[model samples]
Target: MKEKKQNAVTALLEYAGNYKILTFAGLTLSAISMLCSIVPYVCIWLVARELISVLPDFYKVLNVETYGWIAFGFAVLGIIFYFAGLICTHLAAFRTAENIRKIGMAHIMKAPLGYFDNNASGLIRGRLDSAANDTETLLAHNLADIVGTIVLFAGMVILMFIFDWRMGIACLLSAVISIIAMFSMMGGKNAQLMADYQAAQDRMTKAGTEYVRGIPVVKIFQQTIDSFKTFKKAIEEYSDKAEYYQGKVCRIPQAVNLTFTEGAFIFLVPVVIILVPGALQSGDFIDLVTNFIFYAVFSAIISTALAKIMFASSGIMLASTALKRIDLVMKAPTLKNCHDPQIPKDNSVVFKNVSFTYDGSSLPALSHISFKAEAGQSIALVGPSGGGKTTLASLIPRFWDVDEGCVEVGKVNVKDIDQHVLMKQIAFVFQNTKLFKTSILENVRIANPDASYDDVMRALKAARCEDIIEKLPNGAETILGSEGTYLSGGEQQRIALARAILKDSPIIVLDEASAFADPENEVLIQKALSVLCKNRTVIMIAHRLSTIVNADKIIVLDEGHIVEEGTHQELLDKGGLYHKMWNDYNQAVKWKITSEKEAL
Candidate 1:
């Protein structure tokens, strides 16, 4: 059996959860309002009939005031019902949008951390938040208008034919043409054009976010907007799509639709003129004039109803595109949790013939890599750029899963361990550090929520942040990135080290932790590393080379493969890649020292 696919409105109702009844109630009320609104026009026809029956004697119309009051009552009733419908739909729309945002965020939260590398936070927020907002229009206004307009058209059809079938058909002809024009713009190949236009909009939004975040770099490079070619191209693409969709795809159809929709009486006028002669011969000229007046007044309602359909159809298309974007966020791959999780016996980390490749890449980042860091031992990964050092470190904490083979912790495969438990066993510090806009005390305590204020202070002290705290107005209580309380690159690194120290995990992974530190801060950060890595199974990626000279084991990697493995002195004795790298490091150091002396 084939399963049925849901349209955008149906899918949105599902998100409304318990509020689905409100949407139904709103639509019903909207339909009733449309029926009520038709009564006023019917009253007009009746009043006209009575007046024509007693021509030239206005005082003989006894029910004119009664019909006027009835019309006024139904008009007021229609407005009340419409407002009540709006209230119901507004509540449902709010709930649906809220649920969509929550569900989208919850789904993406479970995805692997590596997924964020390709998807930016701003882009994700735009997709979920902005797209959810777009759906509100369809739920609240467009849906009610659509239902009301449908009911209005049904009532109009019966009323039009009731007076005279010929006049009814003539009035309906313009509406038929208007509907055809509207569908021509909204359906078929133009529908695909709308989808493409929406896609171009999404690309533009993502590119704009990236451009804003890179403003600092752009200014530092002294570049103009043209320097960001991706952003410029995205803008141009969006503009082209907009112009093509409006000018080429929608222009003729839209013009035709409006022409017929606003001029619904065009066909009715000619039909009434032709019917006048036959009515005169049959002594029914007064009835013809009354019916003509009725149809002429009724034609206004046809224009209103068709306009609603046009706008509602446009809203439907926008909501469908928005739902597609929301689906993209919801469909991101999440890290699979084991049915029966295992606990590690110790902190030992191992990679057994691990081969991993990033998504959308033909080449593997790490291929057939094998190494182990025993409990309480420090293993260093030293390699040139693009040698998979960072990729190897990322695997230990399951930031990304291996494509083949396995990463094991304490002889248990990482995949078998519960995600929370696996995370508690390892603490990773990246080359770049991010600090929240909260107090330093809260930032450090985030690593261990149950940790006391005293515990956070102790961790900060161990990380040698006393110098940083002393200069702040509120010491450790000061908020970072607020009120002029910002830390330098090295200072932020120390704070990150403090977080890891507070976590007190059995395994620590450091990816070039001191890579960006100045000479003074580098010494402080190195001291902090000593305190954090004590008695832990440490996996370190280093580019400075000097930091890992005394490591328990050194693995030198090149081109995703291990080319040499030994202690620093043993590798130097072998006179291979490590030896040449060591010689180069020495020469660089000598050049730095000679240059400084010459400047002095």
Candidate 2:
């Protein structure tokens, strides 16, 4: 908990560094506000003492014009300070939040790509929300309370000492004891409650995100409201835990303050009357009453400060946890490249004993895998699901670094080439076609945002999306539904193809680009594929073997091992895993066709 507190403080300072001016202003405003807060307390004393001094008989309440005027003047001063502090506090608090958000976003974006993969998107979102909450807590409670409490505590102590040393000593000791008790009790039950609440909130966030993203799948499977039970359970646990801990920590502080306040009054009154009566005179008695009032107000402020710290301690811990999580990602060492490595002179990829493993996994995804693809030459990766084919394809673009050997582009180590230069040479079309929720033209333009209308049209025609576009009233301007739900699977793939064409990169990675197409759509897609693959270094992962039959090489993977490597004709002649799998797949397709014809 101590370490977490330190880390949270560090993170806050680091984030706040960007808006140092704002932070300074906030501190100044808070101090000014605290200074103003003292006015009302002092005014009350002045009014009370003056009323006593002016009254002929203390019991008789008589008109006190000077007292009234003095009180009004003090009240105006108090109001001015109150509002000034409010405005400044808010300004500082909001600016701190804004700075944190900016830095947090930059940190996440600049982090390694693998960071995004290992952690859930929902979890990242949760931390962002947590950071904002933490900042608010720090500004609203920690910042304001600390400033106000110090001023109030100090002022009251001085006033008490001036009035009577005995009362002053008692009050000071009680304040110290209260603060010590608060710190001691705050860690155990208070921290536990906070941890429970944070855990519950994280679970709910994850569940909510899943519910939204998988709503369609859930409805299709007739599992509506699947998250309702979990949500209710989380809320219940959070509420129960909060109430339990709230009673545990807060009640103790309340008891401590009550005991000390009552004890001071009971023990000190008789002592003061005996020891300080001659010194008290009439003025001293008034001082005693006013000093007690000051002590009362000051004690409230001190108790409030302790309470703020107790609650904010949990926030600080959570924020620390979030910052550490974020830092782990942000500080991850991304694969860096040279200043200006030559763009692929030709789209030839060579892997020399390359290997890779996802973090925390014992086994490598691609083990000692080696292969080569020359410019304009096609290579097909064939394997059952989970056979490293996708992993191997990801390496060409340097998504994950090889643990053992190197991957080269145009005979140069990829690590030595600039990332932009390398990415410019490669275009990837994944099995799952992802279309943004925007106009089809804008979606395609993501590949090359500066491409002209003619360029868009040419690419669309090549991908056979022109016909589809012409059918729509808005043509390419038509907005896609969520993840292009408005379009069919085949149409989405065509749009994806159009994006790849717009990229016009020298090397292309096609992972099941046409896997979802119907036969008629597949025929058109195959034509588009031919156009896309023309004069490009292409590595295609084909589920349907027919797509890669004419490729220069077909490499088969079993588990993490490369079981076979050959051309389509050569692999068939060898009659190994590739041949048997190819034969089985062909038979299945034929059987499906026969069954469909029969149904027709």
Candidate 3:
């Protein structure tokens, strides 16, 4: 039951979809342009004929001016048709690119957050956006030219035979050889080579982006460009491979193709002379010479036409590779939505024997874990670094569906509930706070767009952001990430809390929400959390055990299993992982105090 693999051309056309009508129009116009393109050549032939008819008389041909005007008219028509074809093709190409990017973005939105964890953002952007751009160039610029050149090839063949079939064959000798050379050069092992090129480019792009984003750390560490292993290696590998590939594979064929095509007429002169006695000796002598003249004139143009084909073929290969990469993005699975979605009756959260494995991993991240946070209670998850605290909390919101067992909110399985409705019931505050590039007020208001300016202000105040806002020249109107109004980590963390407060969902999941807070902001953030978590079913993850000491329950986890669950003192009484972690935390706090006093 294997899926059939689509060729690159077919895949690209499928992506084009309904927009192909524009492509068809472009092709039709391009074909017309090709016919028109030969009109000037035809004019030359006609003028030659008239000139020969009045040989040495020089003034016998009347209305000779008419043919010149007609030739000019045909030339204008050819240019107009080609321009129109380009316009149509370009329109289709741009639209196709936009649609693919938009569609890819929409799929990424619906994909599991784990997808982001495994895939680099730069790699994804480079593959999708670069593919779209390559496709646009192929269809908008290359395809139109390809179609025009094909039509010209056909017209040239027909006209050559009409003039004289023997010399027609002679005229195409160089083109045929060039075509064979191109096929030999670009065909065998081409698929794998193109794929390798694309993969190398993607790796280089990912490394470049990572290096740029990490420049601050690099500068702080006083690292040289050569010390950035990934970036340096990627650049060198890409450069070396590209150089090797071009030098080894292309040099001979390209030189051969170019030389023979440009010199096709040289071969023709000897061939025509050899065939004249048999082919054109019985024909009128003047007619024979005239046809030879036409062939001589067309030989260079044939070379140009053949060259266009080679260029188009190269673009096709690149575009095909791009299309294949884009297809991979399109094929990524989205989270399934329930057809008959259930509604939750209350704000209680439950995980029952849930086992989950991350994509491309053999071991389960969470194994047969069970937990509950009853309505109007805050249950904090405490564990070592590799414990399943985040994974367990993530299950309730269906960030990933459990491979075994169910996660329920208010007695209904989370997967059975409508995704949007389920999201509406929960508010999330992550350790890494995310704020849009907008005003502080607008960022808070994103939680509830319908929330008024007054509502946002109240949330900001509750999250302890009043002092930060007051110092800004534009107050709430100042944009984030622009101008000179950048906030520290603690400040952004408060804004995140403000967003959660504004959301006011019945269920709140906080993953190390105050991890970024400075001492002064920590107290303010604690106050904000107390307000935001009031009467809500809260599932929180905190690295700082002191912050979660007053939770209704603390669940201690280790290596994908819950080791113990009870009140703070209750877990301390058990003398397990939690108890040891608590004892260590207290000793760390004492050491900090002792160190500070000694420094003073």
Candidate 4:
């Protein structure tokens, strides 16, 4: 058990990294300060001895002025040293926190898209930020408190023996009991409990975020907050767990610990009174009583010191949990790149009998999916939902490496190309457009930050977003989601298209760019898409069968396998899956409301 705790402490100190030197300096200074703090008590004992030597003639105490001056100086120096130590520790702590946050964000940026798919943005932000902040708190104040308390406790023990071992033992017994109470309360079971508590907190945060984002759907369905099962369940479970921990798990031990620590004097006075009479002569007994007073006064300091130690103990436990959470992201594998990278000579995309399974899943997302999209050709992947249309398109961008076979560009394996170079060669327009809370012009210019105002205007015009810019009060300078300057789904899509157009990459990947467009905006977005796709090699995943009728090639997939492949007319003649889907789509379009049919 002792070894386990030592290991945890070692891990935390190791994580301090470059700041360890500063931490060591702080600890050393804090120990010096603690020594100073205790020296004043020794001075007080000396003054007491001088007064005792004078006996009835109280005014004749020898060198009283010298003892008084020395004691005052020790007290003052303790405060100064404590302050200096804090300055060093806090500075080192801030630096450590900054580095951790930077390292965490860098890792997330390089992680695979599949990691994002399986985790919610809110969960990631909450867990990682909490972990970083917890570590910061530990380093900033908790660590100093911990080191100071240990030093103070050691000083008190040594002085106890020097003054009188019997009295020292009496004073030390009170501290031992307090320590026992603290440790017993947070026994072996607390580790698992702490883990459970953190998990519950994360679940509650995720559920709450999901509820807010889905509020529109909830209102449309006439749903009450209480009716949201996941959110409600999360709140209930978190509340229950917290209540159980506070009210039942550690409640008794905590109460006993606090009581014993705060009232240590109550346990001391009786023992002192009993010992004063029987141990020695009147003069010696007076000396023993004076030393007991030393123990009594220092007991208060001991209680305060141990309180700080207990807080540091809690910080250490919490930091252990935070580190485990951080390790999940830090240790996740990134896309591997070859030492010698090769450039693709052309924009042609090919899947050479590829297979892929999602992380933490047994079934393949795409299996044996072989196809070719030659340079300057528009290829559309159309299929039922969950049939791997989007998954196959994602592989081309190296979002996830294939489990079997390979995906290539210009006959070179995509894995062999540098990630930044691979990304520079392709542009994506997702169905759900994401815009930062920035000016319209800046959001559009994200594709090429170096592009000037005129260049951004050109791309916006090509994507048919001129009308959106004209309507905003600040024209293109207006901030998104501010001052009623928000755009509808269709407008956001066009702005996204403008971003893609600005990219001007050799390959364009569109995932139903017009999925949320109204009948009016659909035609405009389609027109913009035509402009974007004019000469680039395109791979599109569209739910709308009619829109991709003129695509250079259509691949129909089902359950991770390609079932059919052809153009509009050729597939219709073959009477295959695409032909059946086309006929079904036309029937749905022709269907109408009963009232419209009756009126007609």
lDDT of 4 by residue, 1-600 (tens): 344446655655665688778877887788888888887788788877778768889879777788788878988888888888888788777777667667878888887776787666766765577677777767777778888888888888888888778777777777888787776756676756756876897789879988998999989999899878999999999999899877787788777777777877777777777876775755477777677677777778867887898888777777677777777767766887679999999999999999999877899989899999999999999988999998999888887888999999877899999888999899999998899999989999999999999999999999998899898999999999997778999999999999999999999999999999999899989999999999999999998988899999999999999999989898899998888899999999998778866888
Model 2 residue 111 CA deviation in Å: 4.3
Cα misplacement distance, residue 472 of candidate 1 (Å): 1.6
Model 4 scores a TM of 0.94
What clash pairs does model 3 have? none
The candidate scoring highest on lDDT is: 1
The sequence of per-residue lDDT tens digits that candidate 3 reaches over residues 1-600 is 001112655566666778888888998998899899897887777778778878898799765678788888988999999899989999989888888899899988897666765676766887799889988878887777788898899999999899888788988888888987786666666545645665787689878988999999999999988879999999988887677667777778879898999888887788767867865557676777777778888887877888777777767767777877787788776889999999999999988999998877888889999888889999999999989899888888888889999999988999899888998999999998878899999999999999999999999999889998999989988999887679988899999999999998999999998897889988888899989999999999988999998999999889899889999999999899999999999988787444766898
TM-score of each predicted structure versus truth: 0.95, 0.84, 0.94, 0.94
Model 4 C-alpha RMSD to native: 2.3
Model 3, 59: alpha-carbon shift in Å?
1.6
Candidates' C-alpha lDDT = 0.90, 0.73, 0.85, 0.84
Q: Any runs in candidate 2 off by more than 4 Å, and if so which?
A: 1-6, 57-96, 104-115, 129-134, 169-181, 188-193, 211-318, 482-485, 591-600
The ten-residue window of minimal lDDT in model 1 covers 1-10
lDDT of 4 at 20: 78
lDDT of 2 by residue, 1-600 (tens): 676666666666666665555545555665665665555666666666666666666655454455566656766765666566656656666766677667667766645555665666656765665556656666545655556556656776777677667766765676666666665555554656566666666666666666677778777878857445665566577667666666766678658855664444444555556655655665466666665665555444445555555556655665665665556545655566577676556679998998888777898888998888887899999998999998888888777777889999888888787788888889988877888889899999999989998899899999988778987768898888843438888889999999999999989999998888888788888888889999998999989998789999999997878999999999999999999999999898788444766898
Q: lDDT, candidate 4, residue 415?
A: 91
State the lDDT of candidate 1 residue by residue for 303-390, as single tens digits: 7888888778778877888888799899998889999999999999989999999988999999999888889999999989999998
